[model samples]
Target: MNAIQFITQNTQLDSKSVANTVSLLEEDCTVPFIARYRKERTGNLDELQIGAIVKFKEAFVALEKRKATILKAIEEQDALTPELKSKIEQTVDTTVLEDIYLPFKKSRKTKAEKARKNGLEPLAKIIMAQRTTDLEFTAGKYANANVPDEAAALEGARHIIAEWINERTDIRNQIRTQLEKYAQLETKVIGTKKDDEKAQKYQDYYDWNESLSRCPSHRLLAILRAESEGFIRVKISIDDDRALDSIDRKVIKSNNACADQIAMAVEDAYKRLLLPSLSNEILKQAKEKADEAAIAVFTKNLRQLLLAPPLGEKRILAIDPGFRTGCKLVCLDANGNLLHNETIYPHPPQKQLREASKKIASLVDAYKIEAIAIGNGTASRETENLVKNTPFKRDLEVFVVSEAGASIYSASKIARDEFPNYDVTVRGAVSIGRRLADPLAELVKIDAKSIGVGQYQHDVDQTKLKTALDTVVESCVNSVGVNVNTASESLLSYVSGIGPKLAENIVNHRAENGAFTSREAIKKVPRLGGKAFEQAAGFLRIRDAENPLDDSAVHPESYGIVKQMAKDQGIPLTKIVRNTAVLKNIDLKKYQTETIGLPTLQDILEELEKPGLDRREKAKAFTFDQNIRTIDDLRSGQLLPGIVNNITNFGCFVDVGIKESGLIHVSNLSDSYVSDVNSIVSLHQQVIVKVLEVDIKRKRIQLMLHKG
Candidate 1:
């Protein structure tokens, strides 16, 4: 009907909250802004709830546009009637709306169109009435030069009846319901593709049969991918006899020759028209559901990876490990600025252990390195061992970082701009080092898909995948407030209201005018209007500003409120901040206004309690068991330390100091049924798992979570 009614019906949210959220969205207010700042207006809805409301609002608008297009098309054909127009206007379901307009749709000549042209409409109508027992006489009356004889005329009449049966809304819905609930997806392998090398990955799905409704999303996507690659043929099937019987009861009423004629038309309609169209429609709907599920998995994993523990502001030495190419090393300062670059060969063709050790010790002493990070790639384990054995004057922690998207970032334009004189190896080493210092800032420069944490990423819908990932990145960026003076353009671009162009402008302004002194100084940037500032102010932090509140999450609009709290207590604002004793005793009711409710007041108190606190955990160093180097070394029932690198709906993959990661199926995750894998383990979490089975030939390892 309308935006408010449609969204309310679909979501079952408070109509008033939905109305206010829709209004805020129409005004170009971002989701983070509304969820954080407008608590009183939206009934204190969270980001997820507000995001759902936005989705339904967009769906309602798209539905109305489609209705307008269909209504205009019907009127142009001179087939618009009062009853038909009223039905089309009142319908909300897309499928039902299309069914109402099917009869008037323009198409190429078909059997029904040819039959109507041969003056067989009268004969078809008589058979449909089911009261004409003498169908031969009725058919003879319509016989002409075009029909030739009674048999020919009857055949044409059957074609017209079949089309009428196909166009009936109730009949189509009945068959659609059957397909939706009871259809099975069957696949058969192609004879020539059975032994093909590229087709072996999908061999399990080559000859498979499963209920379409019960099939998992990951399995369905795999089957569809195999069919598309020409390795198998898939068919969606249902009980033909049962479906035909149901349709016969609906169309045939009289026990005579007319009834028999209707029965033949019903079979033709079910076999030739209804089955093919509805089967494809049902398959499309299933694919969409699978895409959404896969996207949800990707979104969750990306968020966890983006907010992974950061080794905050540490001077570090990073290495991109390799064998014959040697290990590429880069030394970075506390702010992640590169100070020195070189190559060291501790293994393989060179075997210059003495020279490599001396270089590392010299760099640590010269650059004041506090930690060492090695890339988990070609020769990760060997490099880690070397770093641990080397004798240094001071104690330094050795960390192994996942180098999933390092190569992609090394060749990117951003990397080129950051390092104009260095080669790709040096750039990659720097990425590894920066990731150890602060993961959120460095990972933002690379693409999410290249991060290597998703399953079936290439097969899912690209547009939907990008939208979901972008929303997650934005949510994570705003939740952990950004430092205005130190954040890169990539990180600043994900702020509440500042997009790519505005982010570039902010960077340029900072370069020319030096660092931002306070929150008010942000307004001086070009084209950053009042609305953008209002949306972006709270999420942007300034360190060591003249006003102490600039570094906190408190919005500029509420600065007066914080000052009032301090003035009423007869103390400076600095004393009230981070003083739990004083902050806990202050009465929040005295500060509440018409626009500011208890929720806003509580948030202000919370911010004052811990100002400019990084919400991420501190990074800790992990060491893999040296005895286990490859899949061949793993033994059954042996427990070892590991880290969760990727997650999916079915299970999670853990790395146990080898190139081939082990799989821990959902069944092995715990004793109880696991509906979600994230509830148990997260990305980059240290876990201990016991080896259940190892297939050396296939390079597969099965692991079970070991609590003890």
Candidate 2:
């Protein structure tokens, strides 16, 4: 099949649609752009589908190029027979192609080649065929040419056949498949030459053994890490009986001397060559699976973290908690604009407690602050206590926000643009406050992986983790439209079509040209282009604009249709919005087209019902017990309310008023099968868990979801 046809078939898109997307992508049109602007041509494939088609097309082209190169390489060696050439050409998978080209491929000196050069091919063939032949006669045949002893002759013949078995592509493939299905991975810890006290965290992995397929990603990664640090050795072994039986049935039959030699040769080939290569391949595959699982967990956490409810355009005073350096406080207006900044010495030594309180009261009075956001970092609890007890107006509420990546954003370029004259600490306080205003918009400024949400996040594959988290961020940002006029460049970058550069351009254009009055003004931004506008416009809101639809998520392309519907209903667009009576009468089926599907239509209808409405609710304020500050305070059978920090393949980590979170293993996640922890719990969700076990020495806390 042609590239477009192949992509369409694999991805379940129309052939014509795939072709058009591929052409646009090839011409450097971005995914968001094509999905938005070229909807008519591409049948309105989403950015995700267009991206899949682009990736598939590239992979197909790469495979074709690799096939041609392999064909040429084989022909250049003059070992390309019609049968072999045809087999190679027919091979589509890279692994199978490499397997077919194995024999013809150049290699280092091998025992079989050496033995053949020494005139032992005849003896080797007899051994391979497993013919009923006397050993003395075989020895004589080999010795006649070199005048070697019986042992050396047998060795030479065995070496020749061993290499022959190793060179057979079919045999290797068969063995690899069998080993992958049946092999048991064995891990042993390296006994310390020194004291064993220094490396106890790896103690459990040192003697672990499990089937590769059944082993979880975290455990596998742990074992690999132990092995890498010279604290353990890992090996894969198949059941000897099954392995021998398969080889005997496939390669050897009669119990002759030749048969015995062939069996020995095959065993040697597997032990000395094939097994090691196959084990490495299995390990590589295992690592890939582990990385994917870790990335999935991280992605889920990031999504939850980003989608956490916003405080809804309220004025907030953010305090970045500190001790010796004092606290950095910044006040942000309703639209996240910085209004004031100050440093408060709320803690010891400089203990200007009254002055700190007075400064906070004045700032709150000046900005009409509706809430107080205190960063959950060093001295966070102290700050919270101060805010709670201080005699401020009873109308103001206090929240302790997880300022995980606030520092990272404070030093970012977006922060620089927003507060050019402010110090990083001051910027950090502003970020903390803005996050309370809108979590998704502010969090997108910092890297998702660095949000301190997942377990063992640093130990996972960084690149794969980053890509997955980035995808989740993009999906979340686009899923909830951003305020085009108020969104920072970092937030804008996560929009469907707009990326880092385009986001920067948008921000730059805004700074130079002032606030955008309508979504149409975005197209005038340099380098934004039509495609970028198409993907981003629907998700960007221009509140109180000339066109009421611009404030809603109704795509500019669908404006005429929405207006017509509004006119036919004999109501203003505003009345139709969020009015169930007006919305129920509208027939969505009549609007069906090749470009717009049920999913997009339903989404548009929902947006029309609640134009520019934030779907997330205000998060309830929760505080863990100060007395139970660490795992030491957690007792077995004790039930405690905790927030789910992360959900991984193996378990969920819940922070139950402790420094170290407890793990609720997958088996104990629920009574029924809990195949995925994400299905059971999510990040920042409050859950009551019972402490199942606590290993104080190991600092491990095992928790159960079944609370009594």
Tens-digit per-residue lDDT, 1-708, candidate 2? 578767877899888888888888877666655664567678878867976886688778887898788889888988778998777666656678776766666354777667777777787777777764678666776675554776777777888777777677777777778777887889776665224665677777767778888888888877777777677898887776666566667888788888888888888877777778777877788888887777767777888988987887899999998889999988888898888887999898788778888888888888899999988777776777777767776488787787788878888887887788989999899888888888998888887766887756776788767766777787788777888888888888888778889998988899899989988888899998887787688889897898888887778988877777789899877677788778877888777777765656776788788787777878667776665756678789888888887777888888765557799999998889988888888888888888899999878999999645
Please, what is the TM-score per model?
A: 0.98, 0.89
Per-candidate Cα lDDT values, in order, are: 0.92, 0.79
Q: Could you give me the TM-score of model 2 versus the true structure?
A: 0.89
- Tell me which residue pairs clash in candidate 2: 33-531, 189-206, 190-231
Residue 475, model 2: lDDT of 75
Q: Which structure among the candidates has the greatest lDDT? A: 1
Runs with alpha carbons beyond 4 Å of true place in candidate 1: none
| lDDT, residue 349, model 1 | 95
Q: How would you encode candidate 1's per-residue C-alpha lDDT over 1-708 as one tens digit per residue?
A: 788988889988899999998999988999998999989889899999999898888887887888889999999988888888888888888899888888878364878778889999888999989888678988988888898888888888888899999999999999999998999999999999999999998999878999999999999999999999999999999999999999999999889988888899899989998998899989999999999999999999999999999999999999999999999999999999999999998889999888998899889999999999999998999999888888998999999999999999999998998899999999999999999999989998999999999889999999989988999999999999899998989999999999888888999999999999999999999999999999999999999998889999999999999999999888998888898998999999999899998998899999999988899999999999999887889999999999999999999999999999999999999999999999998988999999999999878899999988
